[model samples]
Target: MKNLGKKIIIIFSLLATAIYANVVAKVYPKNVVSGEVATYTLTITGGEVNKPVISTICGSNVLGTSSQTSIQMINNDYKKSYVLSYQFMPQKNCVIAPVNVEVDGRMEQSNSVKVTVKPAVQDKNADFVVNLIPSKTKLFVGEPFNLQLVLKQKKDAEAVDSKFIAPDFKGFWVKGESQATRTEEGDFIITKAMYRLAPQREGNLTIQPAQLKIATRISSRDVWGGFMPQVKWKSYFSNEGHIKAKPLPNNAKIVGNFTISATADKLEINPNEAVNVTVKVVGDGNLEDIKSFKPYIPDVNVFDEKINIKGNTLTQKLAFVSDKDFTIPPFSLAFYNLKTKRVEKISTQPIHIKVNGAVKKTELKIQRDDSIKTSEKSLHVTQKREVLSKVWIVAAFVAGLLIGILIMLFVKPVKFLKKEKALNLNDEKLLLIKLLPYKDKDEEVKKIVDVLEANLYASKKEKIDKKILKEILKKYDIS
Candidate 1:
């Protein structure tokens, strides 16, 4: 009887828990300003001891309402209310934005919301920020680079009316920047364009200060980082950003540094026998236009060299094609150093080249006399058979006939052709008949006719002529 009473109490507890879980969680925002701070409150009667993690629903165009941890709600069991403060900065003009609410591990349904941002005024101008995109501490002449600017924003602040103004770049051309875009948290982004900077004179060039103005609906946010209490009420705020640029620190040329150096495989070369010499200029500078390569020595022709340029380095390969001894000339290059504020020079060592002309010209030739000797070894190669051309076949037939006549006049041929014996005719006719199929009676008859006609016309080996001609003429009833 006591156990039965305990079972009844357990049943009652489960039923009460189910009833408590049915009260759905609800959170609603209190007066939300466009691009300004707002507050939301969550309520659940007889709620669970664990607070439900809340998040914005997906596919919402508004910024503050969409990101995780955007809204923070403090539990208030005493007042039966939990409140979360948020800042809304909508990028698009949404008369009805999709604002999502999440609870119970699943994102709840979204709420249709109207959004508006207060227009910025002159008195509510924001501050300036300067950021050097593609920021490099060094540069060289004839180099291309990119620079960008952005209007930065503080936490809980919106970047509305803002623009970047480029500074004066003396002796350097200013390429334009791309159009601005607002980040998800409402920051204006400005991208600088690309440019080719050619420094006519080498030196350090300082870029001037760049400025920007950002217009906002209210006064500026605190510059220093700290918590801005949610209870603090302000009707207006301002936001702005600016920029300034500085030159490279060291005495670096626009492209880099310029210097020339040369080297030879050997000082002596036999004429017609080639020797290789390589000249390279290493430094940060334009190597594309350094065309002429007259190795500062005697008998060096610019035409004998092939020049190649990669980045700031110039390179060349010289083929001493001449048959005379010569000396390379000394070379010096000039470049600018930013730290020194003066021009720097680099020198190259002198070189001597000897071309021996007394050597055999055939061996000295570029075609290589060794190749001719290799071809001589291949001249005796024999083929299994030579396929005769039409001209050769015709010539052979004519020659054979002439030789046959010569044999008839000067040698013995009385047993054959025009002097045939009965045995010879029989043999010729039998051999000709054997060429056709034995099973075909018609073909056998045709062969017999062909044999008789062949004897009346010419030798057995030759085709049947006048006798066949007569038979064909008779079939056609021709004269």
Candidate 2:
């Protein structure tokens, strides 16, 4: 009977332990800013537990999870527990969904938790501030200006590491300096960055805010084994602004203060030789807007080249060729000067060139005797006249007629007529067919066609540079 009582007592002890098993969940902070991480914890008591499986939480993402199990004897009583921790990033404010878990052999769920996320805000207690500044708030299209970003911090704040986010410059072309400078202003430390911006179009444009994330060490103290330093993190944002870009005047290709000058590589050259003419434009504005340049000189052929830019300077090279004396008419460029607040034209002086005449071909001749004296029939003995036979005469006439007919059909008459017509074609007519896809908007092409037409109909024949024309056609992708 006593043994049966001991068995009942053991069964009651097992039941009591099972009744005490339970699971609980907890979340820290309950509020955070976007991009900051939050944490969640799950604790299970009195039994073995499996890893918690969290359902999709609204407005937040789960980054990772970790777990630990432990047993201890406290006050002469045995105790066991299982714990799980989760880290997450919140996108916005929302209620976190209930988390699920399995403890021993039974399923359990935790109560839903609410989390709040706020937009980025300036910290009044922060040790630093960021400012974004522009040289000008209004500009003309194709005009250039400066943009600067400055970071100001307390002199005692040590910035161990930092991250910077620059604004997106839409509808504008931007170039940044390679180096940044840091300076001290009284009790503040300042770091500055600079960029050059050129407006690409005319309209209202917005410059987004710039952000800076900085990590700094504030203090240090001696610990158990070593000195421990305290670290703090802070983020700063700069104010955003708008810029207005106005359009340039019609036919005005440049917008800034600039000077233009041109020169020829040779003032005297052979008719078939070529000369390189270079035009340089130095300025503080956008040079890409000026696509091409043309000299308004007739008779001289001009082939333009791609523009080369070096810093604030733009250079264009042209190859000129001609068969007779000609002048490179004054070249002109129109631009709007912001300082003068008016449209101004810059021009280069006329260039006079002397082209040597075409070389004459000299024919080579071979000397030989035209007549030969024949022996007079062995010194006048029966000199029989070399009389042609009737059959021979007929054969000779037929051969001569066949040769004449063949020459008319293949050598002289038929092909010569077509060649004469081709030679009569004027320069403009030839270019029309050769330059199949002529761009009418291109000033250089239009000027070339005008000069060709003038030379064709004018009373005095104007020199034509066939070599330069061919080069121009080839440069424009013509066969």
Candidate 3:
């Protein structure tokens, strides 16, 4: 009877605990700015609890999570609780839906929570500020422009470490340019980073705020009774930037001011030899917008090499091989010129090539020996002549074999016998052609090609060190 009573008491206690078990959800700092992290915590009490499965919090996946377990005894009754905390960064206002958690083998749902996220506000009076400045707010599609991220910090606020994060350029082709430049102003220091942006589509595109995280050095006492350096990090955000891109007229794909020029290594080549031509385009706009040039000629095999672009210049290498004379037909490129504010076309003149020593086909005719008759004496003379001809043929074959053996024994093999002409390393066009084959294979070779093209086509020529070029060629065993 006493055992039964104790079992009943234990059952009652379990029932009471199950009835009192509950889960609650809470979020601190219900309001926050975009790009700021928010914390959500779930508390479970009075029963065995399992880890909750939270897909997302405040419309963003949890960045990290942590849990805490606590136990207490009050008035001879034991109490236990579990708390799960999740961290997430919210980009906009959102509502966190209810999450289900298992407690004592039964599911329990927590109440929903709402968070208000506001756009980042720039504070001018703060110790540090970030600003995203665009060169132009309005431009045509495919037009190239500059975007600068400027950071200003007061002289008094010394940062021990700093990092900058750029926003996703959704509708633009972005290229990072030169390194950031630092300058000092009155009572503040300024740093600027430049990026080249070209719109991919026509629309009103929004660039999210850029973030700058900085850490300041501080002194803290360690357990060893010595002061240690500690850092406190803070993030500053730049304002959002908007760009209005308009469509180009006449379905033009390029927007820039450019000039096209072509040059060939030779206007005349031997039969089966290649005539190398380089077509270059140079100006101050989006050079990458230019497409590869395909020149068509009848009965000629044309090979287009990879296009090389450097700064405002673009170069394309081509080789034409044929046994007959052919003409490279003129081609044109149309682009919306920003300087002219109108559509303009640039074209290349037709190039004619002549092939030397081309083989020609000829018909051969044979006369029958039966058309003539000869006496016995004449026939005997003809037989003697045939025997002599056979002996001479055999003698010539043996002599030729002996000569070939003598030559092979004495002569050393010459590598690149066909390329006997010394390459002109000073000539940008020739150097570019030589280095192009190795461009994709080696990074240093690509840089050389870019420098060569820039020197050849860009308005501001890049200096080429012939010694350096020779060293690279020697590394590749290229003469």
Q: In terms of lDDT, which candidate is strongest?
A: 3
Which residue pairs in model 3 clash with each other?
Answer: none
Q: What is the C-alpha lDDT of each candidate?
A: 0.48, 0.73, 0.82
Q: Backbone clashes per model, in order?
A: 36, 0, 0
Per-residue lDDT tens digits of candidate 1, residues 1-479? 89999999999997766444322322233233333333322333322223444343222332342211122233642223223333333333444433334444444333344444444332323333344344542455544345444444454555455554454556554333456565544454333333233333335655544544444554443324444432233332222221232343344333345667778788887765556667788764445545656554344444455677654567888755556666666665555554466667777787766677643335455466766766765653322123345568889999999998987798755555554433233344453444344325555346656666577466556544556444543554333
Q: Candidate 2 overall Cα lDDT vs. reference?
A: 0.73
TM-score for all predictions? Answer: 0.27, 0.48, 0.59
Best model number under TM-score: 3
In model 2, which residue pairs have backbone atoms overlapping below 3 Å? Answer: none
lDDT of model 3, residue 126 = 88
Ten-residue region with minimum lDDT total, candidate 2: 364-373
Decoy 2 TM-score against native: 0.48
Ranked by lDDT, the better of candidates 1 and 2 is 2
Q: Which ranges of candidate 2 are over 4 A from the true structure?
A: 1-125, 175-179, 216-234, 249-253, 270-274, 294-305, 321-329, 352-479
Q: Per TM-score, what order, best first?
A: 3, 2, 1
Rank order by lDDT, top first?
3, 2, 1
Q: Write the per-residue lDDT of candidate 2 for residues 168-218, one digit (tens) a residue.
A: 787787743537899999988889989788889989988776777787777
